[model samples]
Target: MALDRPTPVTFHAPMVLAVGLPPATLSRAGVVLEPSGVALRESNLLDLRSDSAKYRPLVLLVDAELYDFDPEAFDMVAQDVGAKLGVAGSAREAEVTLGQLMAALARKSAFPPPPSSADAKTDKWDFSEVVAAVAAQGGRE
Candidate 1:
């Protein structure tokens, strides 16, 4: 009697795409694509302070060929929305960059926490002292 071998299971992590490229082009890049609108929706959902943990591994893919592309702004928006951003001129490069980012994220997730310092001190200030300090500065309007 022969034993059956276990089947390989594939895992697909959730991702958000904000690229201007066609779906066909992005699909060819080996990335599981979600609509750019989802990114906007996620942003709004986050603004409402709703739980979006289901949307983990979210990334904003931007086509670097765009005429008015602002990488700095894109990065800021991605950070605000708690998502990663990757910009590439070509689909192949985008795939490579995304893979690298995923690997880096994985490594970061496994990192050990920093050791606590035994000499750390917590400063406790008196409320009356704070009021007196404020009054010395001419007080609030």
Candidate 2:
């Protein structure tokens, strides 16, 4: 996917779209956006290290498109991890901290659908009721 629209954006799937560092330009990283949450490759950790040590602890961003993912699941994970690390007293606190990332995902997903080819070619595809037909096809999720 190009950086602009980032094709194959995996609207219904979780994926890490990009990463940024101060000295280095924003580069794409290979992180699996899973339904349960984001999974980071070992390499991603190394890249993150060049940024800030405080941010070294790898946390992930997640959304509905991710595989088997639910927002509440992450809160549970955060709570468990935080308990082990002796950070917040409960996972509910972690949930409050992750508000920004969660909000961003929600907004991004609300984007309008891309222009379909049907808009330009009348004979090729029909725009009217196309979404309904696709929904009926059942192949689309």
The best candidate in terms of TM-score: 1
Task: Report the lDDT tens digits of candidate 1 across residue range 1-141.
Answer: 998999997653555544564454466444423222222222332332222333443676667765144567666666766877666677676667766765665687799866666557767789999889889887565
Off by over 4 Å in 1: 1-14, 29-57, 114-141
Q: What is the C-alpha lDDT profile of model 2 across 1-141, one tens digit per residue?
A: 656764573232332222221111111122112333743222232443232232332343222232133445444543443311112222333343344344666687789768898667655556767876887788755
Which pairs clash inside model 2? 14-33, 15-33, 34-67, 35-66, 35-67, 35-68, 35-69
Candidate 2 global CA lDDT score? 0.36
TM-score, one value per model? 0.45, 0.22
Q: Return the lDDT, model 2, position 37.
A: 74
Q: Tell me the whole-model lDDT of each prediction, alpha carbons only.
A: 0.56, 0.36
